[model samples]
Target: MQQNNEIPQFDLAEQIMAEQRKNASVRRKGPAKRVGAPNQKRKVEPLGHTIKPQPALPEQEQIIAEIVARDIKKLCKGNARSPRTSGF
Candidate 1:
């Protein structure tokens, strides 16, 4: 345990997540970087509605959403650009 200064059974990637491990100090990821055409507008998806294309929740956005939601009440207040209520 870190209480003993043990190298945690998990590491930087293994702690946050092996799946989330990054090679660079900054990481750029997700569908926009993978599929979407740069500078294009974000496509819309309706609940239970699937368009002819697209994967569910790009990994990067999902991570970013989680980070934003952690302090959502603080980060999103008065930011009308967001589509959903912060805790909605």
Candidate 2:
């Protein structure tokens, strides 16, 4: 008895790529709408006459000065410290 053997006629990779192309072409874009300009424009300040600055309260100014003094003391103390280990 003789038996005949034939290879299957199917390609998995080609079928997958064809399916992807079919899906991409079926996409529909949404409807377009009309757009209008902004209702109000921003105010432009003059070169030298910019925004006016508000003065800080006396109590607030004293607190801010004390905080700044503390920060300076911390920086000076850190710089005056000696290294724990000496290197060659």
Candidate 3:
């Protein structure tokens, strides 16, 4: 029986992996810890005065009507016929 001079492939690979793992753990050690403020829930305070709702503008209705019209036009363009002119 003769002793082989070279290490087996799996053995060589395992040695490399062990070295890598040791280096990784050494690098993972971080700086020393320091004391900080204790974590506490924030305290929320109510507003000193109540907020009143603003009155609606007279043009708001017209602006909303224009938006609906534009959306309808877009929907109609995607389809074969407009619902307003379509016959059921």
Q: Which candidate is the best by lDDT?
A: 3
Q: Which portions of model 3 miss their true places by more than 4 Å?
A: 1-39, 49-53, 81-88
lDDT tens digits by residue: candidate 2, 1-88: 8776888789999999999988886664434643567889889976986687889999999999999999999766766684553332
Cα lDDT of candidate 2 equals 0.79
Model 3: which ten-residue window has the lowest total lDDT?
Answer: 79-88
User: Model 1: how far is 67 from its true place, Å?
Assistant: 0.4
How well does candidate 1 score on lDDT at residue 24?
42
Off by over 4 Å in 1: 1-57, 73-88
What overall lDDT goes with each candidate model?
Answer: 0.65, 0.79, 0.80
Q: How many clashes (backbone atoms < 3 Å, residues ≥3 apart in a chain or on different chains) does model 3 have?
A: 0
lDDT of 3 by residue, 1-88 (tens): 9988996556878899999999998877555654557899788998899989887687997898999999888777856555566534
- Let me know the TM-score candidate 3 reaches against the reference structure: 0.34
- What ranges in model 2 sit over 4 Å off? 1-7, 26-54, 82-88
**Clashing pairs for predicted structure model 3, backbone only:** none
Each candidate's clash count: 0, 0, 0
What would the TM-score be for candidate 1 when compared with the true structure?
A: 0.19
